[model samples]
Target chain A: MKFGVVTFPGSNGDYDSYAAVRFAMKEKVEFLWHKSEDLQGCDAVILPGGFAHGDYLRAGAIARFSPIMKHVIKFAKSGGIVIGFCNGFQVLTESGLLPGALLRNNHLRFNSKFIYIRVERTDTPFTGVCRKGEVLKIPIAHGEGNYYNFESDVRKLEDNGQVLFRYADASGNASAAANPNGSINNIAGIVSAEGNVLGMMPHPERAVEDIIGSSDGLKVFESVLNYCISPKPVGRL
Target chain B: MTTTAKTKKVIVYVRLKDGVLDPQGVTIQKALGQMGYPDFVSVRSGKFFELEIDAGASDIDRQINEVCSKLLANPVIERFSVEKI
Candidate 1:
């Protein structure tokens, strides 16, 4: 399947995402400029990590208003596959495509390191290839990855199984110590209620090559491919 | 008679929701205590934006409110107040 990686003005991870899909997954991919509204008929779209608009006002706040986001938002509502990582995830939350907000890190420091995240669910398109409770070692780099939402909304997210991943230890235990940014309930990633959109803090694109560190991130792309070939009926199209 | 639109200055204050944790604020409060200001008790950090709007614009209040909610502050974790001053 073809994938589209969006490149905002300050996007530094766009090339990484493009390389991951083009080389690692052997899939067709293109860079979609933030000023362009066309998606180029891509089956899936990836909002790669970076300090878009210099993370002004707030992380991902200005990037959410990019011209291309209008089409991306529309595509997601139509059940298109969209995955956002790092600053991309922040944009998703800011755009209201996903619930909650990402705040400054609890420690008031920029964190950049490999962290373990347990796959909480495998039913969604983004995690179809992942085993439930499987822990993937991925790199997270951001100063504002602390996720937060109203207690009631968080409870609803949990009840709906919208939470797809959580910060976890090597043994897959979702504990406070494993929490990288003090996200509520150690939430590392989550999918929309419709299950077509996903937002995560970790940099899966940066983990696709074993030479760099680990190849576990390849599963995320593979899972999207698997879903495209045989999409299961979702609640809403 | 033709009248030109006048620019009106407005300020918007954005703060983290009451129940939301503010790590920066906490860190500042800690630093204050270490700096010999023990009676400070607590601190909350926030930001404000000054906007220049056209006074003759229709539905000025609604527009300002919309911008404040949609861009100035994230409603999920932030609260915003607008002032005409």
Candidate 2:
């Protein structure tokens, strides 16, 4: 399946995402400029990490107004697969494609480190390759990765199985020490109610190869690719 | 007939909603307490924006509201108040 990686102004990780797809995964990939209002017939789209639009007013706030986002919004509404990583996740929330908001870290410090995230559910395309409660070592680099939502919305997300990944220890326990950003409920990643879109703070693209450290991040991309190649029936015909 | 449009200033104040955690505010409070200002109860951090728009802009209220909701503040975690002066 072909993948489209968005390149918003100031997006530094677009190349990393493109490289991961083209070289590491050996898949067809294209770069979608922020001003282009086209998807280019790609199967899935990736909004990579970085301070888009210099993260001026707020992270992802200005980037949301990019012309390409209009197409992205429509694509996601039609059940298209979209993954927003780090700053991209902030964009997803700012665009109202995802729920909740990312806030300043509780410690008010920028954290850049390798962390563990336990797969909360393996049903969605993003986490299909992960075993139940499996932990993957990924690196997170952000200052406003703390996720906040109303109590009711949080409960709704939990009930709907929208909570996809949580900060966890090496043993898969959701502990405070494992949560580098102080996100509510230790949430590191989550999906929309329909499970078509995913927003996460961790940078999986950075951990796609064993030479760097671990290849666990590859599972996420592979899962999406496999799903796209062999889609399941949504309902009786 | 001729018409002249005047520029007006709009101020928008944005703050985290009740119960939302404010780490920056907490740190400032800590510093204040350590600096011998223990009587202060609490501190909350917020932001404001000053917008200069033409007074004759169509639907000025609606436009300002849209700006607040779409760009100035995130509705999920923040609440904003806009005032014209």
True contacts kept of each: 0.89, 1.00
A61-151 per-residue lDDT for model 1 (tens digits): 9999999999999999998999999999999999999999999988989999999999988878888888999999999999999989999
Model 2 chain A: ten consecutive residues of lowest lDDT: A228-237
The CA lDDT at A119 in model 1 is: 94
Model 1 chain A worst lDDT window (10 residues): A228-237
Misplaced by over 4 Å in model 2 are A233-237, B1-5
Q: Indicate the docking level reached by candidate 1.
A: high
In candidate 2, position B36 carries an lDDT of 98
Question: Any idea what lDDT model 1 has?
Answer: 0.91
The reply for model 1, stretches above 4 Å from the true place, is A234-237, B1-5
DockQ of each: 0.82, 0.86
